[model samples]
Target: MSFRIVDLAETGSTNDWIADHPEDGLWVRADRQTAGRGRRARAWTSDIGNLFTSTFAAPQPGEGAAPQLSFVAANALLDTVARWVPRERLSLKWPNDLMLDGMKVAGILLEGHARGVIIGVGVNLAHFPEGTERPATSLAAAGIAPPSAREACGTLAEAFAAHRRRWREDGFAATRADWLAAAAGIGKPIVARLGNADLTGTFEGLAEDGALLLRLPDGALRPIHAGEVFTLGDQA
Candidate 1:
């Protein structure tokens, strides 16, 4: 599908703009966001020179669950960032986060709208917030010249379109395979924080439907439908 880009000097949040205008194939980009947020409504620092963009795509039948789109976004993000930096330096964190040298440099937030789902992506192009819950880094911090927000957004749209088409045609199996190949800390000990409780397990892999497969101490695999996953030290 073709995308129409709307470049905004400033906005409350690119995702919010996309939410308001739920047009299929519409890309909303902002130089900076006043009220940017990540998963679970966590505030995202939208410093200028970073890339904050969101796109609206109508849901389709037989396209798998809405949550699986996170994988699609993650794959596209990996491709987008690889254009500048070495692909080996980038890895995908669970759900929808892009890591640079083991630090989070980008994130994807998927929200359901009236028309479909609004996917908001934030990339630390030239700047990254300090003292975040987890460590963060940017392309510039990695010693690579970062692309402009507009340039990055354009590349993102193209990559997103390609992955989305693959999703529509090839289904989640193909996307899941690629995601696992670039996944970080697989087979390592990790903790999945499910709000009030934390479950320790091994990062086995992903289920057929994209649920995180957490191997427990009892030799059973628990499919995590939703939670905050973090790789832990050798304590599991």
Candidate 2:
């Protein structure tokens, strides 16, 4: 499906903009954001040369459509970035963040409104924020000249449509398998901070419904529906 792209010189946030102007098949992008944000309302530094966009789509009738779409978005991002970066150096962090060599290169945020769900994506093209909880990297810092925001959005829209088609036809199992194959921190020790409590465990993988399966020290398993994860040795 072709998406209607609305390019903005500056905005508060693509996600917020799309939220206020709810419409299906719309892709809203801004060259610079005055109020960009990430998960848990963390302020995202909107440098002049990065990709900040949001796409709106109606949720499929199902219990897990939101989480399933998150996986679809991740796969689409992986497909787009893999063209310029080596596949071996890139991995999808569970739920949203995309990593390049263990550092965050991109982030995805999904918000539901009266009209549809908005998939907000921010990629570090020419610059990355400093002093973040997790270390961040950019395509330019990784030695490849980053694509223009418009070019990257074009690639993302195409890739997202392809993955969405696959999800519609093949279902979540297929997307889950693909996401797991490209997942980072699986089989490694990690910490999950779920609001007030923190749990340290081994990253087993994902459950069928897309919840994170974390095996604790006692050998029991915990399904984390939401949290911030950190690979054991990485700075968080």
Best by TM-score: 1
Clashing pairs in 1: none
TM-score of 2: 0.96
* Tens-digit lDDT string for candidate 2 (43-118): 9899988999999888664424665789999999999988888999999998898999889999999887886688
What lDDT tens digits, residue by residue, belong to model 1 across residues 169-228? Answer: 999999999899999989999999898899998999999999999999999999998988
lDDT of each: 0.92, 0.89
Residue 82 lDDT, candidate 2, scale 0-100: 88
How well does model 1 score by local distance difference test? 0.92
lDDT of 2: 0.89
Worst 10 residues of 1 by lDDT: 227-236
Worst 10 residues of 2 by lDDT: 59-68
